[model samples]
Target chain A: MLHEPASQSGPDPASEFKTRLGVWMFLLYCLVYAGFVVINLVSPTTMELTVLWGMNLAVVYGMGLIIFAVILAIVYDFACRRRESALADTPAKGGKQ
Target chain B: MAITAFLIFVAFVLGLSFYLGQRTRTSSGYYAAGGQIHWVVNGVAFAGDYLSAASFLGICGMIAVAGYDGFLYSIGFLAGWIVALFVVAEPMRRLGKYTFTDAVDAKFDSRGIKLAAAISTLIVSIFYLIPQMVGAGVLVEPLLGIPHHWGVIMVGAIVITIVATAGMTSTTWVQFIKGSMLIVFSSILVAAICYRGFTTEPDQGGRVPVHEYATLAATEADSRLTVAEPGWEVVETHEDAAAKAAFAKLARDGRQTWWLISRTDDGVALKETEAVVVAANGTTLINGAPPSAENALRQVGNIEQLRGETDVKSGSISPIELLAGLSDKDTVVKRWKKASFTDADGGKATVYYPTLTRGNVLMRPGLKFKVQGTVLERLDFVSLMLALFLGTAALPHILIRYYTVPSPAAARKSTIVAIIAIGFFYVLTLFMGLGAMINAVINPADSNMAAPLLARSFNSLLFAIISAIAFSTVLGTVAGLIVAASGAVAHDFCDRYLRIPMDDRQKIRAGKLAAFSVGTLAIILGIAFKGMNVSFLVGLAFAVAASANLPAMMMLLFWKRTTAKGIAASIITGVVLSVGLICFSPMMYGQFGLDPTTAPIPFNNPGIVSIPLSFIVLVLVSLSTKNRNSGVAQPA
Candidate 1:
């Protein structure tokens, strides 16, 4: 319950939350892969059959969302790095060295 | 031709194994084949090892009868390899000594991690080995004309011999050979299908009545032979006028087809006694005395042969037609002995199609989860998934595959190859399955008959080749699993636990003996669990991998707060929790004749729950004790 948001360095617990959520993704994959075959043993259909049972909708959407989220996180990380790099490269003119 | 081909194939396989055994003298050679397998050989071996009979025969059988559902296993199995390639292969190669545990505990000096890992490796491997043994037993019964138990024993003995003599060196080359042969023969079978087309009957459906089990054992037999009596039961499926009309149109279109066989049962008393079909029209005479008409029944002869060249030219309509209305009882489809199993009440239940319904009652969940709506049900799914995601990185057999090559790069390359090969194979499963569905040749009585039956529809030569290759693939996979299990027990646990001081050479020697012991045990278990569904057992292996070993590996890689104690706790926790959930779930209980509801868990799968618990435990423990090994725990 105490796990939430994205906490890395600050007084935030979000970082812990992200890791726990990642475990959820892993479980979803397990269920879909294992459960799908057992289901196939019973229902003999095309759409349900051709498209792998657990893999069909969930994996595609889940992966797609994750990719987009990753891209946004990357962009934010990049901008922050750029600002820090510029700050480091700036001339020391008025500081009390 | 059959005996000659069989001898040649056996000679070739055995000879190849001997060559590999010669190279397996060194510890490195025995354990990881001196890390010198060519990627191409390993690549195909990977395919060969990965494509068990469960994949070849099981999936094909599923596809042939169950429509699309059968190919579903192929897809799921292959997709797992994709994860192995992209995410795990190279990273796993960089970690561990003998088992997956070695990798996780690399950062921590913890006995708990060692024990937990050793146990996981043992559990997954033994479970995995059972299926291979079961498949072997099944194949041998038909080929060698032995009992199922005998067949299982033969496989066990053969596998142990191979593993004991050569270690990983022999194991890898065996896998390499088995892998190559399986694919090559499978391709040949596919070609035969394309060239000769399909058959209504192998031996032209002219099995001049072999004394198989079913014909004689109207009474239950004391043995499990590959063959049973043949009699097609009829399944009456509902078809509305509209649907019937559509079917009629489809038939009229010439593309829609039907085939039939005229079967006459010479009711042999459960031995090899003969009774002939008599003319039912009327009794003519008998030795100058009036004979009873009751003794005569009309036997239908093949008229299609005289009716047209088309019937003569027809290649493969028989298998499909035979399966179409096999259970209506009204449709007197001709077949050989249909399989029947006796229940505990001694009620002789013919296992053949009294009904083929895909209802939940038939597909009831295994003992794997909390109740469907309960909190544990949700937790179980979560645990199973966690284990799967993490397990790939932790499987000892999978991990050692990385060491079969020179570097992490090669491991990465091998993974890519595995993904592609596995992916293509999965796709082929769909076609193989769909083809089986329409195929009339596949025996519905035996799900294991799917692939071989499909090949039989084409030609005998192909059937022989595919069956042999399928057998070899079992050998290869079993060998790999045994190697993994043996290494964990010998190198990690024994070397660590007993504190046995051994030179590198001695260590390797001990490992070989361990391999021998495990191989023997596998044979025994395989024979015992022969009746259990292998795919399900494999799923259990996957669950254990995902939960017990995965958490520790992940914590080691990313968590700066990790300590030896945390790693140990998580691994032990993951293994116990995941396994407990699975055993107590409805799936296991139903399988073992225990009350499903009596178990506290709901969903039969535990990966969704146990895997996460592992990671959580590892994280919590690590954070709490991070100060103890802040510098030491950092990745070297």
Candidate 2:
């Protein structure tokens, strides 16, 4: 088979850590999202129940999913930036030079 | 007024494109804005690029008509961005140069991968583009008082110029401007809606009159009735046959008249409602008269009763109060259901009949998604949600935006900004939709005009501004898609896969040519698919993207055993299976003018079946082709 060097840039010292962090967050979100789909599937009437602030589960959950994503994204960004900075400062420790 | 606003908006977008065009001399500059855009600007532009006509017009219209079912789309669409941010954003930025294909083929350098990825990119972009173009047409018809096709052509020509001239630089700035305007304007409209609150008689006190259906009392023995106003002369009424059978016959006969038999306090009553009829000889009538200034189809959508309020208007309220009022049990919203039929005189008629739904029901899921429906129906809802959640990360236009940013961190940060902006915009959609629902401004024949029409209900100036923003929404998204498609054609298909030798100048030229070609193709498809629900088409595009691109991207990034053949095979499988299933699905069957029930696939969405199958195919193919995986990039 013909071989070619990878066209992407050299890997960042924080790449592995970022991937791990991203995957975990993604899976965490997946579970909550799945819960939403399951509730809708099993008993749609549950959505009509007034849950919080006079809004039903449908509005609450739907809006919650959107809001939660924003929160998760902000947290993820802060964590990644902090880790990347840490790795940059001590390249010989827990990361490749 | 709307036309002038629309013209001014278009001119500003074009002028911006020309100003940016001067800097785009090199291939990289044209394709990725020299990879120097500010992360904040890129982020809002990302929202602009992502929020197509489907997100703005389709979702609002869906919410306006189906209540909470429309908000489900907003949730699903926003959730998909989570996938983009957490999974694809940084890696895509780190790997690719310009297009999504560049990122996927970074390790393999295989012609097969290029072919598959480019083809998938083009197909997905075209599918995504059609709805935006159609939405442009839909907007222009009401706003500019022009033919739908003319609007499609104008948008196509303008977007082609925008993309062909400045490429990514122009597209990104256009998106950023549009994204900002959309958020600001939508916020204003939502605030206005909250200020107006709930009103049982929204049309009273000099507002546009709501269309009212005519109801007449009838004895059980009455066999024939004559209606004078709506041109139904000597209408034959039946007592023994079921209502469904009578309606079915009327539907089959092309009759424009819709009659409903209901039990009132004073015996049985026959109701004749709003209809638009077109005779075989080409004459048109709305409510039995020619469609003149005074005889046009009136706007519909109003609250029949407000909970706990005998007063006609609730004056002003908070956003929470608005939601509370809509979900109240005693509040009844008057929504419409449409049907079409041919009459005995060879005239075609479409009618909209009212269904008074409780406020609580209107604020829940059963209106459109039918979560409580049959198993297949529920599956359809599940599949749609799955597609929306997975599709955002996989969409080629969105993926390409990652490359426009400088570093992987910039990609990540910008994506967060996009999520916040997009999420906030979607939340506003709920209020705008509910406001339109009770404001008596929905165009019954076309729900896609709901948001703009709702803006018009407040005043003409808001309407013009909202409509203009909507038109720019289409332009921004179409420019992004065309740029993505053109990149695939020029960089992936022609230069790499076909082994066509070209300099940077030639490559940019080829990309411009591809942009024009794709723009033309989008115009044709947009005009051809006129009147199809914009959101449904976007959902199908999402399904295809999720099925064809997501599995390959996920496996390649994480799974070490993934081979070039596997990626290529999975892409082909994803595209073919999703597109094939869509063709045989019930929705397409109905589009083909066949009985929807006779479709082989009972459900309309293809994501549930196709997405998993693509992943399985990728794994199986990768496992078998492990020996050929020689110099593949290790999982990051």
Candidate 3:
């Protein structure tokens, strides 16, 4: 996001972008989690409804949340790497400082 | 063979500690392992340090009893690491020296920040320590046949030795070894559970008796007690006025068996009742039979009764199949209940009886957190979830791990590793808990022994390995907590607050001394808090950590206007409010021998109230002191 490759005078645009992405990702996950908790409160019996191959909704959803966390972390790491590479390529091409 | 395995494990850890201690001479090496640990190893070590007795024994026990509600803790615990990885991990590594206080006080060199942060760390460390100590006591009773108090003291002494000798260096190595072993052994255990499959009885080939609840007739009664209901004999009775009064009141009220006993001249006869009791330690007496090894632990399991499928009494099943089979409503599951009543023949007898449950109901929530619970009960559940979700990043012991890695980037990478390891282990806990439940391996009296007892169901060898690993689990976690507490005392408080300028040698000395003091205190608290579930104690610890430390931490990292005063005020408020609320909570009132209704706090968990209160205090205090804290908000 910035022309400068390594300068720390202000918040690096790449870092800022990553931070924003991270926060949004976190919020997205939180929404899913909160939805689960709310459902548990509002109509808890829904958690017992079978959604998968004979398994209840709560088990499937709980397992999905755990898997989702791993996927999010992996995505963030990749994005950070891509952003680092983009910054490296940008310094040579020259853009906004 | 079990004793041998446990001995071998203890010897290996102590030997490793002394070897690591030889290399850790400087204050930095002693406190932060010289910031030289590899990120991957440090990450696994994080798992080792974080998965205390509570994670292994307590969660499994809760799952064995409460089913799905227990896994909620695992979810809450793992989710918190997301905050740790993305938020606290990097900044903490960049800012801090040794202790959590170092990180909080990095931007502002105020003495108040140091004192408040240090005290907060001590309070959290002590709170976290109690459960680990209690777990240790619980383990030793079954493993070595030693008294609970002695077991607690043994753990305290061993952990102190580990912390005092090599400090963070040895602690890290122990954690790494412990973490790896725990995962490997747990995986093996899960494989065993899936291989053996589910059975109606704890013993593989035995058949579960289809016993219906029966009524027993009391032939006689005395002044101490009388049988009000025919066929339901009241066997036990207490002559004590308070006991009689309570029983008579309950019986008169016609509520659930209030008067459990009656006093007879010949002896006390117990009210014959049937329940699904998670049996306690010792020989389990079933149907008033003689206490024997076979009936010692209460057994529970789900029977698959699919629409077309004939009843398969016992067979091997995959994890998915196990859950699916359990989800079938027609399947029967057994649960135990313990009822204490005065017996005409036996005074004050608590009997374990099996209660039949539908498989689908066992698979859902509401066993512990009822769906029809009151508003406050629901709020309490949410509050616990919030605490667990927010507590990981703010834990003093967990935060101190950031300083163990070389750089901020390493800290972040290590946190990711910790997350994966921890997350996987939590998933494994579900199968372990279910396995314990189905196999009837639970110690009915103390649910904390469920996992280890589950291992015992298979064979003595596997049981030995799992129990020894569990012992190591306690040691690794307690050692880390002690190290964190020592850093708070010798470094944060003594150096920063009291302004004790010590040479490197003296700094190490002070840290060792501090470790001893904190370890002793942990031992005492552990003994005092016997019989309480370790996971419940850990939940309280999370609430305190999230409330007392997380608000200040998040503000300092993200808020450009955060000041020292705000941080200090938030810490004090969080600690005071949460601890104070816990003291007046219904649970505490029960401990104090008073009616739960008399307690001022309606909620069991203080996180919902305390966390928000902390954030508000931080914001208000920071705005008021904005002028005095010039340039402190800007990161160097």
Candidate whose lDDT is highest: 2
Per-residue CA lDDT of model 3 for B1-636, tens digit only, reads 778998998888888888888888888898889888899999999999999999999899998877888888888888888888666776667678888888788778878888999999999999999999999998987789899999999889888988989999999999998999899989988888888875543463343453233322233433544444553433333343322222221122332232323335754433334322123434333434444665443444334344224445546678898788777777766665555544443334454444556767777777887654999988988888789889988999999898887766567778888888988999999899988877756656677788887787777788899999999999999999999999999988897789887999999999999999999999999999997757767888899999999998889978999999999999999999999999999988866668888899998899999999999999999999999885366642
DockQ rank order: 2, 3, 1
- For model 2, the stretches where C-alpha displacement exceeds 4 angstroms are A1-10, B210-212, B222-234, B237-257, B263-267, B308-311, B631-633
Q: Can you tell me the DockQ of model 1?
A: 0.04
Best by DockQ: 2
Cα error, residue B207 of model 2, in Å, equals: 3.3
lDDT of each residue in B530-590, candidate 1, tens digit only: 6787666777877877777767766666666778878878878877887787788877886
Cα lDDT over the full model 3? 0.78
Can you give the lDDT of residue B207 in candidate 3?
Answer: 38
For the predicted complex of model 2, DockQ is: 0.51
Taking the candidates in order, what DockQ does each have?
Answer: 0.04, 0.51, 0.27
For model 3 chain B, where is the 10-residue window of minimal lDDT? B243-252
Which segments of model 1 are wrong by more than 4 Å?
A: A1-97, B1-6, B191-346, B354-393, B595-600, B629-632
